[model samples]
Target: MNDSREQYTLANGRTSINALPKVSLHDHLDGGLRPATILELADSIGFEVPASDAASLGEWFEDSADSGSLVDYLATFDITVGVMQTTEGLTRVAREFVQDLAADGVVYGEVRWAPEQHVAKGLTLDQTVEAVQQGIEQGIDDARGEGKTLRVGQLVTAMRHADRGLEIAELAVRHRERGVVGFDIAGAELGFPAGNQRAAFDYLAQNFLPVTVHAGEADGLDSIRGALFDGRALRLGHGVRLAEDIRIESSDDENTFVSIGGLAQWVKDREIALELSPSSNLQTGAIAAWGDDLQDHPFDLLYQLGFTVTVNTDNRLMSNTSLSRELSLLSDAFGYDLEDFEVFQLNAANASFLPLDERQDLADTIIAGFQSA
Candidate 1:
C-alpha cells in the first residue's frame, strides 16, 4: 500500500487531499517503521524475522495486526520492539518515521512509543530518549532539505501492564526541554485502569506535564472516567467508546434528539480531544458495538455533537493508512466536506501538546493551507 502515490480529490476538484497540510495526534513510532527499514535493522542486530523479503514482511505485519483480538494484534509489536534495541536502530527508525510523515503531508506530529519496550540492547532510559531525539532532528533537517517543513515531538509512553509508570514519567519530565513533549499510557485499557498509575499521574500533574491516555478503545466510559480523574489526561487516545455515553432517544430528518451522560458532558464541555483512528478502530474491534464498518463507527455522531473530534492514523503501517487516507475515509463514510476536514485539523492542532503559541502557529498554518486549497 504505497499511499504516498495515492491522491484523493474532492467532488469540486479544487484540492488534492494528500497535499493538504495536516496534524497527526495519535501516531506510534514502533508501528510506523518502514518494512524495508525493519528488515535491515533486524538483520543488523542478528534478529530473526518471520518473513525474509520486505514485501512479505509488510504483508506479515498487516496480517498479524488484522486479527480481531487485541492480544493477537499486540503480539505483532514484539517483533518491532525486538529490533529497536540499539541506539542506531532507534535513531534510523525515528528518522525515517519523520520522513514518511513529511511525505504524507503532516506538518506537525506527536510520535508516541513506549521506551521500556526498547531496553533489550542495554541502552539506558536517558540514552534511548537522546537517541530518538537525534534521529528526529536529523529527520527534520532532511525534510527541510526536501522543501517540506515538519516538526515532531515525542509523547513518551508507559505500558499499562508494566510497573514502570513513575519511572517513565520522570524520564519524560527530564526530557521535557529536549524532544519529549508529553506523557501517555498504552496497552490493555480494559483491565489496567489509569488509576493504577496514580504515582506517575501525581508526579506529572505536580510538574504540569500534559497527559493523554489510551482509553475508550478497548474499554467503556469507566475507563475514560479513570483517564480523566486519575490520569488527568488532556486527550483521549481513540476515545471512540465515549459515544456509549451518548444516548439517542429519537430522531427525525430535521434533527436527532439525544441525551448526554455526565462523563460525556464533561468531556464535551471541557473540549477534550478524541483521537479517532477509523481503520485501526475497525481492525481492533473498538467499534464492535456499532458495527464492523467505518460507516457504523460513532465518529460521525461524535463529530455532529461537537466533541472536539480529531482524525488520526493510529498505526500507519499496521492499519495501512495515513492521516490523509483517514480523512478521506471519514469523508467517504460520513459525507464530510472541506469545512469538516478543516475542523478536524484545527481540533488536532489545538489539542497538540505544544505550547499555546506554537499551537497558534500550527492553527495559522492549517488555515493558510485550507484557504489556498
Candidate 2:
C-alpha cells in the first residue's frame, strides 16, 4: 500500500519515472494521511475507524473511493479528517505528508486542506494553519535530512458548502508569510458554484492572493465559467470536464477535426492550467462522460490540442496512487515517453503558485534532472 516506494518506468522501460524531479499542484493534505498514523491518532482520541490494521484501512479507502462518484469518494475523508482535530494530529499528518511526497520524488508540492474542518476540537482557524505549517517545516527538514530536496506550501481551502469563504480567505492571506501559498474552495462542486463565494474571491483579488477553484469535475461548462469569471482562479482543479466544450467534428485514420467552443477557446488562449488527476478523475466519475478507461481520458486530446494540462494525484491515499504511478498509468494508456513525462512536470512547475523566479528555478531543476536521467 506504500505506493511511494514502488518503481515506475516509461513505456519503453528505458528510463525510470521515479528518478525525475516533479511538482505536485493539486494534492490534498487530509486525503493523503498514512493509514498507520490514522490508526494511532484515532486510538489516542478514542475515535472509531473502518478498519483495524493499516493494510485493511488502505484497501478500504481505495475500494470505497472506487464507487465512481465524487460525493461517495469524498465520504472516506470522514475517517482521515476525524483524526486530524488536534495539534499533534495536524502536525504529524502534515510532516508525514511532506515526507511521503519527497519519497515519491516530488521536489515541490502544494498541500490543500480546509482549515474549518480541522477546528472541530476547539482550535482556532489560525491555530490550525499554524499547526500544519509547523508540520510542513518539520517535514521539509526531515526530507533534507534524508538528502532529498523538498519545498511545500499550504493552500488554505474553504468548504464550498460553508459560509466561511471570506474568513478562510483572510486566514490564508494572514499566513502568507508563513507556509501558506494560495487559497482554494473545495467541497461538493455541483451545487456550490464559485460564484456563491464571490466575496471571498473579491477579497483575495484585492489582496493579490492567488486562487485555484475545484471546478469542472462534478459539473459542466457553467461551473468552469463561474470558477474563471467569479473566483478568478489562476488554475482549475480537475478541469477535465472542460473537454465538453470541444466538439469532435470528425475523425479519420490520421486526422481528427475538432471545433472549440468560445469558453474553451478563451481557456486555451489564456493558457489556464488544468490540474488533471487521471485516477481520481475516474474514481470520482469526473471523466465518465468520455469513457470508463484511462485511454478514454481526454488528457492526450487536451495536450495534443495545446491545452495547459498538468498531471496530479488529487488524493493519493484514496486512489492508492502517487505522482509516479499516475504518470506511469498515463504512459501505459497513451505510449508516453520520458520527454512527454518531462513536459507534464514542467507544466506543473510553471502553473504552481510560486513566484515567477522560483517557478523558473523549479523548471530548471526539472530540466536538469530529466537531462541527467
Candidate achieving the largest lDDT: 2
The digit string of per-residue lDDT tens for model 1 on 1-373 reads 5454467766676678888999999999998988888889889878999999988888898888987767777888988889899999999989999988888889999999999988877999999999999999999999999999989999999999889999999999999999999999999887899999999999999999999999999899999999999999999999999999999865567676899999999999999999999999988899999999899999999988889999999988888788888888887888888999999999999999999999999999999999998
Alpha-carbon error at 369 in model 1, in Å? 0.6
Single out the weakest 10-residue window by summed lDDT for candidate 2: 248-257
- lDDT tens readout by residue for model 2, 155-244: 999999999999999999999999899999999999999999999999999999999999999999999999999999989999999999
Q: Clash pairs of candidate 1?
A: none
Q: Estimate each model's TM-score.
A: 0.97, 0.98
Off by over 4 Å in 2: 251-255
- Ten-residue region with minimum lDDT total, candidate 1: 1-10
Pairs clashing within candidate 2: none
- Local distance difference test values of all predictions, in order: 0.91, 0.94
Best by TM-score: 2
